[model samples]
Target: MAALFSKMLTKTDIESCLCIRASPLGQLPFEEGQRVNMHVHDESGQEWIFSCSIEEDENVGRFVSVGWLEFARFKEILT
Candidate 1:
């Protein structure tokens, strides 16, 4: 069974994406390059759902990065 792995933020890319680290127990059930849907909650308790691809695996020492699309207006302002 595939499990939902929660991660801690290790770094942030210039594009506003997150590079997260894994758990001390072990590697996640996900495979490298596997794209999966994820959910995140903001401070106000609203849940946001999105899809992202896995960028790392067990060999990478518990670090994984998530790349996602930025909102059109946000991308324009950042550029």
Candidate 2:
């Protein structure tokens, strides 16, 4: 499948406190408050499913919430 977007993980990304920010310019197909299943694949071709909700903020626009930190941890991402 084609990628919707990509980000080089930062220290904050692996932290459990934050969610992955989707680009405002990317214009995701889903609507706000919509729950979507995200398929994440690692470099080794390992795949993980994240059940995320689309959240909108006045300042940040859209972001993927829930299961991101777990995905990072499962991938053993250090950064």
Candidate 3:
């Protein structure tokens, strides 16, 4: 997984920590409050593993899963 930021979309998000919004990544293996490794990859082979959970939105193709780092890292990377 390549942590493609360009492909991220936020519906109703929790912007406190990292948010890996699950719309892009399909079939995540996690239960509600269950900690799992979210593997993300970018186009250039850069990857990120987010300590994530199956939030209130746990649909296979329409929910957002967040990484505790996307919030912190996204800001640093952009500016």
Candidate 4:
């Protein structure tokens, strides 16, 4: 026999957008032209992953661009 359950999802509280500053120099170990998988959690607690570029930089720990998943999160914060 199969069973089903009904659950109520609560509305999530909006979180303040976080402003992150990239390191002056690339301190993280990632090569230019490389990409990293970004994990993002929505207000509803749902999570997603996306790839982002590591743009050319001399710094070791530099953030080139925000991933697609993060872009969505940012958009939500704006609305």
Q: Tell me the alpha-carbon RMSD of every candidate.
A: 6.5, 3.2, 5.4, 12.7
Residue pairs with clashing backbones, model 2: none
lDDT ranking, best first:
2, 3, 1, 4
The all-Cα superposition gives candidate 2 an RMSD in Å to the true structure of 3.2
lDDT per residue (tens digit) for residues 1-79 in model 2: 6765566755655665345577733676677678778787787888877777777678877777655667666667645
Query: By lDDT, who's the top model here?
Result: 2
In candidate 4, the residue pairs with backbone N, CA or C atoms under 3 Å apart (3 or more residues apart, or in different chains) clash, namely 25-59, 26-59, 26-60, 26-61, 27-60, 27-61, 28-60, 28-61
Top model by TM-score, which number? Answer: 2
lDDT of 3 by residue, 1-79 (tens): 4434554434333345444556566666665667777666655777777666656644433444565447345545423
lDDT by residue for model 4 (1-79), tens: 2322222322221232221224543364566578677676656777777665555435435444544535545566433
Cα lDDT listed for each candidate:
0.53, 0.67, 0.55, 0.46
Q: Which regions of candidate 4 fall more than 4 Å away from where they truly are?
A: 1-21, 24-26, 57-63, 69-79
- Superposition-based RMSD of candidate 3 using all C-alpha atoms, in angstroms: 5.4
The positional error of residue 8 in candidate 2, measured at the CA in angstroms, is 5.5
For residues 1-79, write the lDDT of model 1, one tens digit per residue.
3445545434344356655655543666676678677676645776666565546455665555555435323335334
Minimum summed lDDT over a 10-residue window in model 4 is located at 4-13
Worst 10 residues of 2 by lDDT: 16-25
Would you give me the overall lDDT of model 1? 0.53
